[model samples]
Target chain A: AQSVTQLDSQVPVFEEAPVELRCNYSSSVSVYLFWYVQYPNQGLQLLLKYLSGSTLVKGINGFEAEFNKSQTSFHLRKPSVHISDTAEYFCAVTPTGFQKLVFGTGTRLLVSP
Target chain B: EAGVAQSPRYKIIEKRQSVAFWCNPISGHATLYWYQQILGQGPKLLIQFQNNGVVDDSQLPKDRFSAERLKGVDSTLKIQPAKLEDSAVYLCASSVGLAGGPPRETQYFGPGTRLLVL
Candidate 1:
């Protein structure tokens, strides 16, 4: 079975500041990684995904993540954040041959003015 | 394109009562999934359907929770004799199915139904 870990429960940052949400996974086989964001009352929206190419994956809203195989990490980063970027972020993974998507607890990004 | 759709944004029911939630996947999506999300936790897949056929349901509480995706488009999930622990958000998501890709297809999600068990 595959599992995801998001060490930080919450990350507070000011507007226009850089931020990074850490994520790690454990899997016996190769896997795919993804980052999703959820607004207050909406469902999750895909921020980006890492399937097979380019360890550095860029996503919408100026967000990006790096797939570090040796470190088993896929950390999401943004050069600058806006107040509207405040939302719950999630990291998910699925094995190369499986269909089940395992998600981390979540990291709430709180952006202040 | 329209995303996944779910009905009854919020529902309140007492323990031992029954309630049901509805979901409609994207027009051409062949795979649908139902997930339960507790407060402060990530969503957990309770059941998965591939064109009206059961694909995986190992985590579902079969004794009280049941779900069906009829016609391979719309689906309904029901919980009988609800428990206080059942108070959580129920999310519905859909993907292009195995034919599109394996472990790579993006799963679009719905607004989710918030169930409150008192």
Candidate 2:
């Protein structure tokens, strides 16, 4: 079985400021990682994913994540966040050969003006 | 392309009542998924369907929950004698499932149906 941990329950940031949401996972086999965002009253949307090659993966809305194999981390980062970036972010993991995704609790990104 | 679609964006029912949710996945998508999202928590997979056939339903509570996708395109999930704990957002997602391809396809999600049990 696989599990995900998002230590931060909430992250507060000012508009145009840099932000990073941490995500870590535990899996015995190689896995694919993904980050999804959910706005108020909306469903989860894929932000980015890390499957194979290139440890650094970029996503929509100028967001990006770096897959640190040794650290077991796939932290989402944005150079400058906008007010619209305020949403709930979820991290998910699935084994390389499987399609069942295990998700983390989620991190609420609060972007203020 | 259109994303996934779910019905009754918001539903409120009393405890022990029965509720059902409808979902229509993207055209041509062979895989569909149902997830439950509680407040302040990430979405949890309740079931996965591969073209009208169930692939996984291990986490679903069979005593109260039941789901079916008879046509391989649309699906319905039902909860009988619901409990307060069943109050959550039910999300429907779909992804392209090509035979002999990697299983890492990106899943597209619907707006979800919010179920509140009073």
Candidate 3:
């Protein structure tokens, strides 16, 4: 079984400031990584995914994540955040050749004006 | 393309009551999924269907939960004698199914049905 751990449950950052949401995972074999964002009263939207590619992957909303195999991390980061970035973020992983995605608890990103 | 659709955006019922949720997947999609999401937690897979046949339902609580997809299009999930802990959001997702029968695939989700068991 695979699991994800998001160290920070909440993050408050000033508008236009850079922010990072930490994520770590434990798996016996190779895994695929993903990030999803949930807006208030809405379904989750895929932010980015790290499949077979370069270490750094860019996603919508100017967000990006780096796939670090050694550290087992895929932290999401953005150079500048807007108030609209306030939402619950989730880190997810799935074992190679498996379709079931296991997700972390979540980190609430609060962008203050 | 139309997205997955779910009915009864909000539901409230007492413990021991029964409730059912309906979902209509995107046109031509052959794979459907049902997930349960408790507050402050990510969604957990309850069942998966390839067309009308179930592919995986290991996480579903058979004692009180049931799900089915007929005609390989729309799906329904029912919970009998619901418990207080059943208060959570029920999410529906659908995929194009494995192209060339590949195992891993990405999924598109619905808005979800929020259930509150009193």
lDDT of 3 by residue, B44-66 (tens): 98998989999889999999999
TM-score of chain B of each: 0.96, 0.96, 0.95
Q: What stretches of model 3 exceed 4 Å from their correct place?
A: B100-104
Q: Place model 1 in a CAPRI quality band.
A: high
- Sorted by TM-score (best first), the order is 1, 2, 3
Better of 1 and 3 by DockQ: 1
Off by more than 4 A, model 2: B100-102
User: List-wise, what DockQ does each model earn?
Assistant: 0.80, 0.75, 0.56
- Model 1 agreement with the true structure over A65-94: per-residue lDDT tens digits: 999999999999999999999999999999
Error of 1 at A56 (Å): 0.2
lDDT, residue A90, model 1:
98
Question: How would the candidate models be sorted by lDDT, starting from the highest?
Answer: 1, 2, 3
Q: What lDDT tens digits, residue by residue, belong to model 3 across residues A1-113?
A: 89999999999999999999999999999988989898988878889888787999999999999999999999999999999999999999988877677889999999999
Superposing every Cα of model 3 onto the true structure, what RMSD results?
A: 1.3
- Candidate 2 contains a number of clashing pairs equal to 0
Instruction: Give lDDT: candidate 3, residue A14.
Output: 100
DockQ of 2: 0.75
Most accurate candidate by lDDT: 1
